[model samples]
Target: MAVNLAHFALNADDIPTSRAFYEKVFGWSFVPWGPPGFYHIRTGAEDAPVQGALQQRRELIAGRRTIAPECTFTVEDVEATARAVVAAGGRILMDRFTISGVGHLIFFEDPAGNAIGAMQSDADAE
Candidate 1:
């Protein structure tokens, strides 16, 4: 039941523009994701696993756009972790939600206001 850093996501006002910037500046490459506005970012070789994604700002919940470079952590149980977050004086910014074929996730703010996310794998949830 250990929690681990899972993924990082960047919020962008314009996905194509952001992707181009990262590609030129950092040598990153991107592939379109499920929807029109999302793209998976590849920082290295094509065979290397994608480390993060560039998501359109409008796709995220309100107030979340202000926090770019959001870090998501994998947890044993997102619901339990969310409860613990509240008990520990943190605030839940987004309630538990599921991503089809992926997993359940929740967003929360640390006491100091840093935004973070927790995810529970779909396999584990089942």
Candidate 2:
């Protein structure tokens, strides 16, 4: 199966500042969701709008932090994809985990050291 960019999340130190900037500059809308400091971003695109979120910044893995937007790829099976990632010289940073209403997810770093996520959709993941 071909994996696709399913979502992207922006990590911010200051939610209000980042949210306001996106709202004013990009005309994006934010809806509070999930945890206290997390929000769903609406980009107002006419076509198939890509899923996006803004959340508080934290370590991507242990003491290492990610400064760029975290991108998530949708796949049929996260475990299989994770195996392929490792086979292709990538390193798994996190094991598989459920995201309640979202799906099964795994975090990994590419050979180039870019941290990303792979998700397998399942509304009943909770």
Task: Give the per-residue lDDT of model 2 (tens digit) for 1-126.
Answer: 777999999999999999999999989999999899999998746697879999999887667777899999999999999999999999999899999988999999898889999999999998
lDDT of 1 at 40: 82
Top candidate, metric TM-score: 2
TM-score per candidate, chains pooled: 0.82, 0.93
Candidate 2 residues lying further than 4 Å off, grouped into runs, are 44-47
Q: For model 2, what is the error of residue 26's alpha carbon versus the real structure, in angstroms, after optimal superposition?
A: 0.5
Q: Which stretches of candidate 1 lie over 4 Å from their true place?
A: 44-50, 58-64, 123-126
Clashing pairs in 2: none
State model 1's lDDT.
0.81
Candidate 1, RMSD to the unseen true structure: 2.8
